[model samples]
Target: MPHPPPLGDSAGQPGRSNRVLGRRGCHLPILPQQDGPAAPLPASPGDAKLQRAKEALRLAGHPGDPQSLEAVGLMLDKLAKENQDIRLMQAELRVILILPFLSLAPQAQKEELETLLRKSEENARLTEALQRETASLQAAQTELRLLREKLQGLGEAGLQRHRRVCPAGGAGTGPQGQVPAHYEGLAAALSTFFGSNGTFAHDRLSFVDFLDEVEDALEELAELLGVSKEDVDNFEEMALTQLEAAPWGR
Candidate 1:
C-alpha cells in the first residue's frame, strides 16, 4: 500500500487544520470554525467504529465511499486491529469462534456456508409470507363477521314483514305475534344469555368463550322451545363438523 499523505505541511500553514476521513472514504464535511478545541469523537461504539473505518479508508488513499471494496477493507481492518474496545473484541471473537469450524473441513467450508446463507434467505422470505398471510386472514375474518351481521339484519327484517301480513296470536299463530312459537322462545333465551342488550354486544370475548356462550345459549333456547337436549347436542356437533369442513375453519 502507498504511504498515506502527511497530516500537514512540514513548513506548517498560518491557520490550524482539522480533518478526518469519514467511513467509506467520504471526506467528512468541514467542521464549523471553533474558537477553542475541536469537539470530541462520538462516544457511542457504533459511531466510533464508523468514524474509524472512514479514517482508515482516507489513510489508504480511498475516499470514504462505503460501496467500494477499499472502504469495506477499512471496516474489516478495524475488526482485526489490536484494540481493547469491547465492540472490536466481540467482532473478533465471532470470527475466532467460527475459525475452528471453518478449518475442520476447509474443502467443504464454502459449500456449507453457502447452504447456510440460502437457508437464512429462505427463512426470511417465509417469515415475510407468513406475516402477509396473517394480515389476509384477519381481513377475511372481519368481512365474515360483517356478512353474518347483515344476514341477521335481513332475517329480522323478513320476520317483521311476516308479522305485518299475518295478525298476531291468530288461530294458527303463537301469542308473541306472527313469529313461530319456537323462534320466539329461542329469541328470548338468546337475549337472556347474551346480556339481554343485543347479539355480540361485548367485543372482548375470545373465540373459545364465544363458542362456549353459543353452546350454553343453545341449551337455554332448546329448553324454552321444548326441544330435547340430545337433539340440540347433535345439532351442535353437526354444525362444528360443517365448520371444520370449511377451508377457512381448517
Candidate 2:
C-alpha cells in the first residue's frame, strides 16, 4: 500500500514529485518597488522647450539680440530689411494664437460675432439711407417754409391780384368800391382747401360748390347792388359755357 502524503507536500518524493505537486505552474511574479530615490521625470518635449525659450527671450527684452556682435553688426547694416521680419513674425504669432481660439471657441460666440458683423453692416446702410432721407425732407421743408413766408407777405392789393389770377370764388364787390371781407375770406379758405397745384384743376367744380354755399351772401350782395338772381344765374351760365370750351374742361 502507498504511504500517506506529508503536510504541505504531495507525496514527498524528489524532483519528479515536485513536478507532480505543480510548483512550476503558470503563475505571475509580483515586482518589487524601485529601490533608492526615484529618477526625476524627463524634461518637457522640444516644442515646450522652444516655447519657453521664446518666452525667456521676450522677458529679457532683447528681441534684436544676435548670436554674436558680428551678427548684430550685419542686422544693423540691413536694419530696414530686418524690421519687416519682426512685423511678419508678430503677425504669424497672432494668427497661430487666433486660429486655436477660433476653432475651440463656443458656437454661440461665433454666431454672436457673425450677428455683430451683420448688424454693423446693416447699421451702416441704414445710416446712409437715413442721411439721404433727412436731406430730402429738409429740402422739402425749406420749400414749404419759403412758400408760407411768401403767402404771409401778401397785402390786400396782392390778395386782390391773387384772386383775379386764380379765381375759384367770384370777385364780388361790396359797398364804397371795396372788395367784400367775406369774398377775401372765402378765397383764402378755398386756396387753403385746394393747394396751389390742385386749385386750378378743381377751380370750376369748387367754385360751383362755393356759389351754392354763399348763395345767400351773393343774393344779399346782388340786392345791395340792385341786380336780380336770374341775372346772376344767366351770367354764370355764359361764363360756364366759355370755360367748358377750354382744353382743361375736356
lDDT of 2: 0.56
Every model: Cα RMSD to truth? 27.7, 23.5
What is the C-alpha local distance difference test score of each model? 0.61, 0.56
**Per-residue lDDT of model 2, residues 19-85, tens digit only:** 2223664434445558899898767666664665555545456545554444444445655665788
Task: Report clash pairs, candidate 2.
Answer: none
Clashing pairs in 1: 22-54, 23-54, 24-64, 24-65, 25-63, 25-64, 26-64
lDDT by residue for model 1 (138-211), tens: 99999999999987886666556444544466665432324333444444544433443333454676647767
TM-score of each: 0.31, 0.30
Alpha-carbon runs more than 4 Å astray in model 1? 1-85, 89-105, 168-250
In terms of TM-score, which candidate is strongest?
1
How many residue pairs clash in each candidate at the backbone level?
Answer: 7, 0
Model 1 lDDT-worst window of ten: 238-247
